[model samples]
Structures are given as C-alpha cells and as structure tokens.
Target: MFLPFSRYLAFALLSIHETVCTELGTSPFNLRPFSINLSSGVRTMLNKIKTTELPHFPEYPGVGSSFGIDLNTLKSLRKEWLTSFDWGKEQDSMNQFNHFEATIEDLTIHFIHEKSSDPDAIPLLLLHGWPGSFLEFLPVIDQLVQTATTSLGKSISFDVIVPSLPGFVFSSPPPANWTVHDTARVFNTLMTDVLGYSTFAVHGTDFGVGPGYALYDEFNKTTRAAHFVFLPFYPLKPDALQALNITLSPLEKFEEQEFIQWDSSGSGYFLEQSTKPNTLGLALYDTPVGQLAWIGEKFISWSDPHAGTGGSVLDSNEILRSVSLYYLTRSFISSLYIYAQNPHGFATEYTKAHTNAPMLFSAFKYNVAFWPPALAEKVGNLVLYRNHESGGHFPGLENPSALIEDLREIGTYWTT
Candidate 1:
C-alpha cells in the first residue's frame, strides 16, 4: 500500500538525514569534484554498433503501419552515428562545464554546477525527464548563467545546477522500491545540506516535474519559486476548470485534440515502462539498435516539426548524443526502473493548492501535454503563464532562447 503524501515526505526526509550522517559522517552532505572519463571498452562497443548489420523489413505506406519510427530514419541515424559522429568532441564539450558528485542517501548523484559571476545570482535547479539526461540542459546552461541587462538596466543571472536523476546516466540507481518522492527528498538534501543554499528555484519538464512538484510541496519554505514546461498531473477536472471561470482558446483546443489523439495511440511506451519495465529493459539491454529505435522514436515524434523541413526539430547530432550516453553507461535499463517503481504516477494530492511558491508555466506549441493558464492557476500561486508559437516538449533544445528569456522573467519575480 502507498503511504500518505505527508507521511511519505516526512519519512523520506528522515531517511536521507540518517543516511548522510551514517555514510559521510556529517549531518549535511559535501560536494566532491568529479570528472567523466568514458572507458575505452565502452567506446569500442559503441564503434561496433556502426558495423552491426540491421535486419531489413518492407515498409507499408499508412499511419498505423508507420505508427513507430520509420525504418529509413533509424537506418540513416545509425550510419551517421557510426561513421561521422565524434563522441570525444561531445565528451569534451560536456566536460568544459563544472561537474561534481555528492552522496545523498544511498545514491551518489552527478550534476553540473555552473556559477554566475554576479554575486546576487539565484540558485536554480534544472531537472530533465525520461529518454533525456542532463544533456537536455547543455544548450541553455551558458545563456542562463551569463549576466543579462534587463529593461530596467539591472543585470540578472542564475547559479544553475542540473543533476542526472537517480538511476539515470551518471547517478546511481535507487533501491528496488524507490519512487519520485524519494528523489525529491534526496534533491532537497542536495540543495540545502550539500550545496548550502537556504532557498532556491526549480524548473522541470517531463519526469522532472514529479520531483519539481515534490520540492514545491514539501519544502515550500526553501523552494521559493517553481517553473514548469510540463506538469505531469494536469488536465484539471471539469469542475476545476469551471472554478477558473474561463474558456479554452483555439490554441488550447488544438492542444486538447493532440493530447486525446496521443492518449489513444501513442501511450504504449508509458504502459510498458510503468508496468513491465524490466521485461522490456532486458530485451533492449544488449542490442544498441533496439535502444535507438525505442528512444529515437520519441525524439522524432515529440519534437516540433522542423520549420520549413520534413523531419524532427532536433539535429542528427543532438539525438545521437542522447542515445550514446545510454548505450555507453549501460544504464538504459536502470532508467526504466523509475517508471516501474512509481506505477501509480505522480501524487495528485500535492497538485491541489499545496504551496504558495510563485509558479510559472510555459505551454510550447507541440508539447504532448498542455495546460491552459486558468487551469494552471489552481495548482499554485500562478504568477506568469505564456503560450509559445514555436518549440515542443524539449524546449530547452528546440528553442533555447525562448526558454532562457522566460526563465529570466522568473528571476525578476523571484527578486521582487
């Protein structure tokens, strides 16, 4: 049986505190400098994927027949990834940023710590969701950290912290029974106890929203503000929509149509991941092409259609880098366990007016899930909500400039 939200939060906090003291011999955790050096053995395995022959299947021309990633797209990506893509170059680019690890509870969390020169910069925690590693934030971290002159002539910046969720990429996997709430508690320890910040703001999309909401609810005093590109527990009830006293706009209606269509046909991955993750996990573990097909399909489908082009908004290199990380670390299977552990989904009770932290929501045009401004207001102290004309689920990569500008707006609300 699942525990009540309040009890779960309390127990999680106590557990993290005890683990920190016992393991590290300190009440608060400490950050240890780290480096990411991929082994030669892993590199050899990745190179082997390029030469491996993929089985050919005849294509039929129809939406249902092509319900998944087209065979042609996967073949092209595999060829380029094997022959031309440079993992070393990508690794060096990632290493240019400050990276560190800290033991919080039973997991050793890996994160990028980018600091701004501005003394007044606020600490901002950026979290990434499934099929996405901390890599999703790489394109925008520099802009977020750079000092920007506002309309009032004041400068603003952020001390950005992007962590690999436990069991994803560099972070160690949690116990078999771990849930998102467990991640939330460990992350709170990261900010307050490890990093020594009394208050911070959070921004998240996809699975990141689970822990993001957890922080907003359980540590409102410390999580001073929150911003989201996706709210996992949304589509407010009909009565809740009535309470907001507003009608859906044309854009919102389009979002609804898209959402319904996806729920009917595109939710197979969700059901499988949340129910029999290990079963699927084992099947895909040793096969590089299988992992690519599973993850690359989402990257292609969920992104905004390329403007004036016929494919995904993401470039070839962008998609390959994400897949390469999973393939290299052999952590693809562990990442899926997060879904199995939290089969019930994000806690709905926390979504109901649990905190007064200033909240902001951005609805990207092509996101699978969309929440209107009125509906968003019911969840928290809705301070700013906007609809974008471009971008999709992965706004950080698809439209970095837009995402950065909106985050700066959050900084203004935070300082005021």
Candidate 2:
C-alpha cells in the first residue's frame, strides 16, 4: 500500500520527458529537480493488466430503456432527435480537436488531448464522470481555446486533456477490482507517464468530481492544484437561510417540490449502486432506454431549467449526448461499481488504499445538495473555498466559462 515517493516522482518525470512535453508540446521550466523513469517494481506493477476486450454483456429485453428517458418523454425526444439532431454532422464538429487512447492499467483509456496554440498555455487534466463522457467538456474546451487564443494571445491556449473514465465509452472496462482511487492512479500515469505532464491542473464534474480530487491529491505532490464541480463532504452551518439557497427558480422550485413529493426521491440510484451495483447494472447494460431514462432524469433534475439562472450552463441536447457515451460503452455496471466500492464509512481495510491529500475545493451552490461547500471544508485542510450563485451538478457542462475562470485563478495562485 505504500507507493514509494521516489517511484511516484520517477513515473511523473518519465511522463514529462518521454510522454508529456513532447506529446503536449512544451517542457516545464525545470525538470532537473524530478526523476523521469519508473522504478522497476513500479513498471512491473503497471504492466500487470493484459489488455483485452470486456466480456460482451448480452443485451436483454427492456434493457435499452435503462438509458432512454421515461417512455413518454423518450417517444417525444426520439421524434425530435430522429427528425432533427444530426450525429454525422456532430461527429465532424467534434473531430476539430485531437483524440487519443493510451493503455493504462490494461485498459485502453480514451482522451481528447487538445494542445492550445499557446505555447505557454497551462496543461489541464479534465475528467468526465458517470452517465457522461469526454464530450461533456467539448463546449467548454472550445470556448477556452477561443478565449485563450483571441483574448489572451496565441501562447495562452490550454493544453487540455479530457479522458473517459475506464469502463465508460471508448475506454476499456476495469479488468477486475478497480476503484475511483485506482482510476485516479491510472490517470496519474496517463498524465505524467503517457502524456508527459510534470505538473497540470485537474478538473472534473459529476462523478468525475471524486476522481478529480483523487488525481489532484496524486498530482499535487508534483503538480499544481485541483478543482471540481462537486465536492462530496457536506458541512452544516448555523444559518438556515444560507443553506436554503437552492438553485431552483420559483417555477423550478415548484417543479422540484412536486418532484420530491411525488417521485420516490433522494438518490435511489446511489442506494442501489452503492449496495448492489452489479444486479442493477446487469439490467441497465441491456436496457438502453432504461439507461437513458435513468441518466436523463438527472440531467433535467440537476441543471438550471433556464440556462441564464446561473453561470451559462449546458442545454438539454448536450446532456443527452454525454449520457449516450455510457450507453455506447455499455459501462453502466463498471461505472456504478465505484459506488459499491465506496469506502466512505467502510473499514480501513478498504479505505487505507488511497491518500486523502488536502484539496483546494469549490462547491457550486447548485451542487450542494450532495456536498455543501461549508461541509466539504470540514473534511480536508481546505485551502480555497467559494460559493457561486449559479452552476448545478455538472459544472463543466453547465458553466464551463465560469469553471475555467475559477480554474485559471486557482492555477495562478495555487500552482506555485
């Protein structure tokens, strides 16, 4: 369990020289301070997984519904999409950026590595979460690149890297018992060893929030800082009014109130996934509509109904496409496994596997239902904290510009 610090630095440097800089397009100002090769033991451990296709989870009847929206809405959305939305056109638009895959812990991890036109542009590791994909950040990435190039200058572009979580879309499944922490380590290897980033800022949204924090914990040892759309720890403050600042507008508040009242509420998915993920995942993997509905519910429920309510946010179509990645990868099960394996209240036997390094945390007002910012600060040595009037669960997709700005600020002040 004791990952040698020496090995860790070596893996990072190996990434910096052989993979990160050359691949990413610039060398850090100084690497003489760090080693750049993996220790033999670390190399042996890293080589353990033999890459292979995941077992073909046979599709089952009613399984497709697992991804599609509720039957009634699914019908309407399907009509709209079939008659209007264009995948071929969309594919070309996405191809404007770079995409690559590298073997990490036996899985072929997929990522979009868009180096900014800016040579001095900061390297950023952007992660997407469950029921989502790398595509979630595409809109934000586009804006960041444009802003950096036009406003900041050509050398101000982001050397951005967005990766699909293992077992989700493009990326291969976890061969055996991979957890979020393990995934974080794999990403560490990817960013440092495969991509050659000696230091980089990490950002994530949704479930990506957890691994993002984990990666920051890992990367902060040699890199800069970490930012997340969702922070898990919740702290109760004295002011009831302060905590009552819900993201819902008057109409939306009525909708959510009705939702909480009528629907069986409060993250039933979390309960199921945390307890019996495989059983539910079996059904979700087969029922695309079911999967879509499950994910769609979160999209509609999580974001601001009117985009302007908070920082500019993702519209409905963008959310759906992000969900589609999970379906295409048939990763509903593997992704849910992170929940089942969560060690939050579990014994040290499982918990001691990873480090809980101090993090620079931000809890968007909308994301507080799960991990309120005041509560999050209690868990770690919180170095940075902020509360936004807007921004819901999926911040990257919701308010990319604001998220990017916050990230740039964190990089400027904390990366040193």
Candidate 3:
C-alpha cells in the first residue's frame, strides 16, 4: 500500500499545502501571527494512502535495521499514521504553548513563549536541532513551569522559550550564509530586544549547541548559565587520535570506536546535506512516504535500542507529528540549509565562553556522539556534568523527564 508520489506530484502536493495554508490564513508568514495544523486536503490524502501497496523487499540478511530503515517497521508506522494518528490532538497540545512570531532580518521567527506564573521564574531558552522542531520540548513544558526544589528545599522554576530554528516549522527560511552564529545573534535579539529579558539561561542539543554556545560565549553578560545534551565537536579519526598521541581509556576506546563506526557508516546524511542538500531535499522533502523513510530511519537508528516505541524510545505519534509539520510547513528542504550554509559540519574549534557562566552538560548513553569531559571542558565553564545510562540525541523526546530534571538542576547553580 506504500507508493511514492511522482516527484512532480509530490512537489505539487507540497506546493498545494503551502499555498492552501497561506490562502486560508492557517500559516501567514507576514509576521503578524500564525497557527499550525495539517490541512484537511492533506489529511484526507494521508488517510487514503495505501500502505499495503508498498513493495516488500526481503529484509537484509543479519543486518536488520542497521543498514537502513526497516521496511516492515515503516509500513507499520505508516499504517498507524494513516489509520490512527491524530494531528488535531497533537496540534492542540502544541497550541497550549504561547506561540508568537517576530521578524528578525526579514525572517518570521515562530516561538513558544510560556512563562511560569512565578514572578521569580528564570528565563531559559530551550533550542532544538535538525530533524526536530519546537515539538521536541513540548512534553517537558508543564514540568518546567513547576517549582523545582533542591535538597535544601531552595526552589526554582523556569519561564521557557522554545523557538523554531530559522527555516523550521512556522519560522521563515533563512538567507544564504546563515550560520548558527547568525542564529545566535537573532536568538539574543529575541530574548533581549523582543522578549525584554535582561538575563536568561540556555539549553541546547545537536545543532542547537551552536547558537546556545554562541550565547553562552558571546553574550556572557546576559546569558547567565547554559546546559546541553549534545555539542558540535568534530570527532577525530583513529589516525588523527594516534597522531596526537591521545590516550583513550577502555570506556573512551569503546565510545571512540562507536563514533568511528558512525562516521564510516551513518554519516551519509551529514555529507549529503552539507555538500548538496538541494538534491537530497528535492528527492525527499515533498513526498510523505519519502519523508517517513528519511526522518523515520533516524528515529530508528539513533534512539536507545532497548527502549520502547520500536526501539526509538519515543512513539510513532511523535514521528508522525514531525513528518506532518515538515510536510505542512514545506520546511524539510529549507531546514537542511543549515547544513549547507555551515559547511564546516561539526567542529574542530571548541567554543570558549568569555565569562564564568555555569555550563551544565548531560551525557546521554545512547546519544550519537560522546565527548569526554576533558574535551567538553574546552567548550565552556563545565560546572555540572551528568552521565545518564538512558536517552539519546533527542533526549527531550526520548527521555523528557531526564531532560526536565537536567534543566531544573541547572537553576541551582544559576547564581553560583
């Protein structure tokens, strides 16, 4: 029942969705305001999909899902999406956040600005990375607004702001050469100039680490403290490590080996997106089934293996929501531009904060990359580092409770 729309049909559907949304006032990028939802036409098309038509290929011998997305799992997920997934429910949940748009450099920035009623609540910028939208942090917003207490009974809470990274859902696409450093400047403006916060905190993961680090480094005066579940450091190859005479402990060896294996095997997305994203985007962005396989594979391969939701930790519902947003906003291709615009890919250069802001990092066991504390220390003032046996790259989705606690704990050291 799985069929890819012809490239023309796929792009047409994409264009229709965008055009229809624009015409209906569902997604107005004029910077006034906007709401998010899958159009009725698109929903009908999705519901009418023939999942059973997907050609069944024999599963690869022994490799299973290690090589790519498992067709069987994808079929099951697609069926679930077509038959049982509820976009309205997900959209309602997202609407619970105070969403607003602000124009920055001619780009309309969409963000969730949820302030805790507590007057003393700390302002924290929660940034999401690629293949993820503001949806990544929705699960933890309720918890973040609650009073967070320390062992001493001292309490804290957060006024959370989650922005759709430029070119992401609801946010207008960026101009060429828009690096995360540029994003960092825009975000600072959002927090300071637009939101009118004199001091704030930050938490980042994946590509989010770029802007989060820039705010932590370049705007140390306003960015009081920061936290991260991932960083942007480039992993040195085995030869490079040997050349530097770098010694690895047994655990570091295991981690480094995992990284090497990922670089050799799992880095096609990075290379393709960085070098020739338009081709990749043209091929997949407009097709729902194609989008499913492309994004769905990452959710499968990059998540904690022993966890639930078909080994992805989070459920297919979230995956479907991701696919839906990418489709409705026609943002998949533009989202990849972050990679194309910042062609250095990961980093040989580590971020150094100019001020002594407390930086907390949570090292999730299943995350795609691991930088030991020694190297990570070079990136900032490493005040709090927690090693977790659970979670992965999308910790906000995979382990929201853990991510929430990490965010909560960051406040304890805010003034230290």
Q: How many collisions per candidate?
A: 0, 38, 7
All candidates' lDDT scores? 0.79, 0.57, 0.78
Per-model TM values vs. the true structure: 0.87, 0.69, 0.86
The 10-residue segment with the lowest total lDDT in model 1: 1-10
lDDT of 1 at 256: 65
Residue-level lDDT tens digits of model 3 in 1-416: 22223323433443455567668875433333345655664754484455325666744656668778877888888888888887777776666555677777778899877667688999999999988989888878878877878535669898888999999888889888899989999999888776668999999988888888888889888999999877767867667677766776665666666677777899899888898989989987657788888898887677776555432347778888888888778888999899988877477876667989998888776777877666678878897777766677788888887788878877778772
TM-score (C-alpha, index-matched) for candidate 3: 0.86
Which candidate should be chosen as best, given TM-score against the real structure?
1
Model 3, position 249, has a per-residue lDDT of 67
Report the Cα lDDT for residue 132, model 1: 93
In candidate 1, the residue pairs with backbone N, CA or C atoms under 3 Å apart (3 or more residues apart, or in different chains) clash, namely none
Superposed Cα deviation of residue 37, candidate 3 (Å): 3.0
**Ranking under lDDT, best-scoring first?**
1, 3, 2
- The residue-by-residue lDDT of candidate 1 on 1-416, one tens digit each, is 34445334433554555567658666544456566777564567665686677758635645432489887788888888878888888887777666778888868899887777677888999999999998888878888878985445567798899999999989998999998889989998898888778999999899998888788878888898899988757464435556767677888777766666667788799889998999999998877778888998888788787731332336878888888888888899999988888876554543554777788899888888767876677677888888887788888888777788888777667842
Question: All candidates: CA RMSD in angstroms?
Answer: 8.2, 11.9, 8.8
1-416 per-residue lDDT for model 2 (tens digits) = 23235334433444455455545665432222211121232222212211212224424436443442345555554444445544445555555555556766567777776665555666778887666677777767755543343223332446778888887766777865667778888888877877667767777666676677676655556446666655433322224424666343453344334334323454667677789888898876655455655777777666655553445646656654555456545577887776766645112121211333335555454552434444444444455655555666667767766676666554334444
On TM-score, the stronger of 2 and 3 is 3
